[model samples]
Target: MSTTDSTATCECARAVAELREELATLRDEVAGLQRENAALRDANERKAERIETLETHVTQEFATIRERTDRIERVGYTAVGHAREHAQWMRKHDRLHDALKSRRERFDERLWDLETGEIDVQDVIDAGTNDLPIQTRTKERKTNPDALRGNKKRSTFIWPEFYARSRKTSGGNLIVTTPDAANILAEAGVKHDNETTKRAMRFVARLSGNRDDPNHEEHLIRFEPGERGKSPARLVADAGEFEQFAREASGMDVTDSENDETDTQDDSDDIVGAEADEQMDTLLNATTEGS
Candidate 1:
């Protein structure tokens, strides 16, 4: 054979060997890529499952929250409704109380007139004393030897004036609001929000016995302490509490249990009533430190 033909045949065989080696390497790379792709696909499926679980949990939580909120709203609405109902009932109770009080007053007045031929001496005293215009009224001439100035005419309120006013104005079934009471005191030269009003309330704290029988001016005024700084005060009467307490304290109480009868406690200052200033002179006997 020729040398050129032999060399050509050798080159062809070498080229075939090189081509087969490259094809095997490509197959190995493809098999590795396929395994990696399968692993990635499995991981993606797990992540999808986790995402679905989270979504379900969030939905359930939202539903529970919505249910609880609805329940709270219902409870709030119920509470509001009950409060309104209670307010209405309270108003009704107040009206009934006023009607009954007026009727009782009328009956007492009638009975007293029939029994004694006139109004009670206390009423006469209250009316006569309270008639003075509040602006011009002065304190009763003091007889206190220890007082700094015994006869100095100063603006003050004592039991007599308050008793007189309260007696005269009570129970046309008058429900005196704090503003109304303040106005009454203002006419007597008292400031609406001053310490004098508080002092007057304290002075009358011992007068709770007025609830049982109209003696000792206990029933003349009942000071109710409520919402002291926040709202205007309201008046409330404790039925038998003050009367019972007074009985227990004195060890012996002289309450008028006698039937509709007028008794002149002191005829010296008769209920026929002289000048208001003169009547107050006799009031020295009623004065005390507690007052």
Candidate 2:
């Protein structure tokens, strides 16, 4: 218990103090590491939330874009259909114009003859210019006994050649039936189902004044009941009104009335047709621009 003992006690005390200090430093380092790990976990959670939000926004935007694209495609198809219809209308108008022009030329020739003393002007004016009728082997019986004295019979239809040429080959008498209406409607790019065809037939019958007088075969149109009552009655357009009625069936630029004396009517019709064409072009251009 002398000097050696005193030195050993002092060394032991110093070692103990050093061990305690090392343990404290280790605890501090562990605490700091735990804090850093917590902060990193919070940052990762926030990043995950942000990614989810971005994904949702992108999904919604994509859906909106898809819907817009579908709408645009439907509109483009509709525009194309309208354009086709307008083209058909223009063709019909051209045919009418040609027919009218030919008639005018014929009248001019007659006028020239009168001016050159080749024919009397009054006689030419008085002469009827009715179109030739369809030939029949058997003469129709007269309805009245008093009016049956003459052997000669006259034609009921006096329409232009264009309408007469369009007559159905199978019908006993030339006329436009429901199938004919459907065909004409199809040419104008319109869907001609049963309902639409029937509607058009009724409209034509009403317009032609044939509905009020069903028995009269001289009207512009005639509706005949099915033989043996097996099917619905069918409509037949008069040879005179056939072409005009076909145009009307399309429900385009045609009207029930026209004033030939109006100065701006033709110009207005042309402008309307042009405007329709321009609208179709605009729709196509918009589709191209989007692409």
Candidate 3:
């Protein structure tokens, strides 16, 4: 063979070897790039999931905040309405305050009308007088309401016969124990059923400031731990709490309102004076401006 032809063949083989090496390097680079792309996709998916979770949590938190705010506003508005109504009643009843002999003035003068009582207890109950569960006595002054009353303070000194009365001048509660109170009610009236004791207990409990009940403000007498909780016992009266509460209702106690009159009086706002037209003629007088 010629020398030139042999040289050309060697050069061609060397060129082919160089091309093969270049192809192998290009394949390695492509594989590395594919691995990096897969890693990037996985990272993006994780970030998206975390964002969605945060959004859901924020939405729930905002909803909870709105609900609590709405509840507070409702309570505030209701209180304002009640206060306005209370003041209106006070103004309206003053129309006949100047009569020579008012119904209440006569309760003070029990001369000829000895047999006819000052107030009809049944009529008062039937009229739904603030829906109170308490049954106070008018024994002593016969005209006086109870110990809770300001001018009639000496009244209710002798409590109901059914209760275990406490004649303590320091003024303790007139109580009948939970079981005793229930048994007595059951035996007294044949109109009640098997659930009479339970119903009566709950009714009294709710009105007398049961902690769980929403009507904690309507505490006419004062009791604790209604039928729901562990201490299912009943309380007939808490003299101190009742005295303070009744005085507040009749617009007598205002020392607490001295600092910020509007705020404190508003805070203590509650509906009263529902016992007027129910033959409890003195109730309006007691509710208006007490002595």
Candidate 4:
């Protein structure tokens, strides 16, 4: 072989060797880049899973908290309602207690006065008289026109005269003849059915000397004039007996008692009198000044 040809062959062989080395380096770099990309993808997937798990936990926690808060609010509202009810009940209880206390005190005072004889039977009669209607005749006339009219056929109209004459009677005995007593007896009879009438008749018989003592049951029976009969006045005197009779007759207590009636009348009278007096005084003063 020629020397020039041998040199050219050596140079070509060296150039081929260098080119192979460069191709191998490029293949290694490509494999490393593929591995790095796979790792990054796995990391992204992990992050997505973690975020989903956190979101689920947060949603559940919020729901539980809301439920607990609602329960607390309901309990608080219930407690507040109960407190208001208790406060109202306490107010009513206090008012009732005060009313009962005042009634008890008044009753006690009355009883003490009776026991001490500071309040005599006559005083009771006077009290009853004070409670009676002042214009009884006027009231009776309004209620029963026939009673007020004088008729020869009616035996001189005895009831009105009897009531008028009885109004002037003195002491506790005559007090029973008052309109108040009659009204009380009538009310008792209405409330108690026949029981009140029976009790009153018995009381009258006792008071009329048919029975030995006024307090005894045996004294309650009325004997016909010579035998056994009921006395209206005697029956009216016993307030308890009359009340019991009223309950039996009417099935209730005498709600319109003389005391209540008197109080109502007095209130009405005060208002009317005040107005009349004011007007009268104004008229009189104006007349005098003009004169």
lDDT of 2 by residue, 106-139 (tens): 4675465346543343232322322111111001
Stretches of model 2 off by over 4 angstroms after superposition: 1-26, 118-291
Candidate 2 structure lDDT:
0.45
Q: All candidates' lDDT scores?
A: 0.44, 0.45, 0.44, 0.40
2 or 4: which has the higher lDDT? 2
Best by lDDT: 2
Question: For model 1, which pairs clash?
Answer: 210-218, 210-219
Better TM-score candidate (1, 4): 4
Clash count, one per candidate: 2, 0, 0, 26
lDDT of 3 at 145: 29
Candidate 3 vs candidate 4: the lDDT winner is 3
RMSD of 4: 22.5
Show model 4 residue runs off by greater than 4 Å. 1-37, 120-291
Q: How many backbone clashes does candidate 3 have?
A: 0
Worst lDDT 10-window in candidate 3: 150-159
- Candidate 3: the clashing residue pairs are none
Q: Specify the poorest-scoring 10-residue window by lDDT in model 1.
A: 131-140
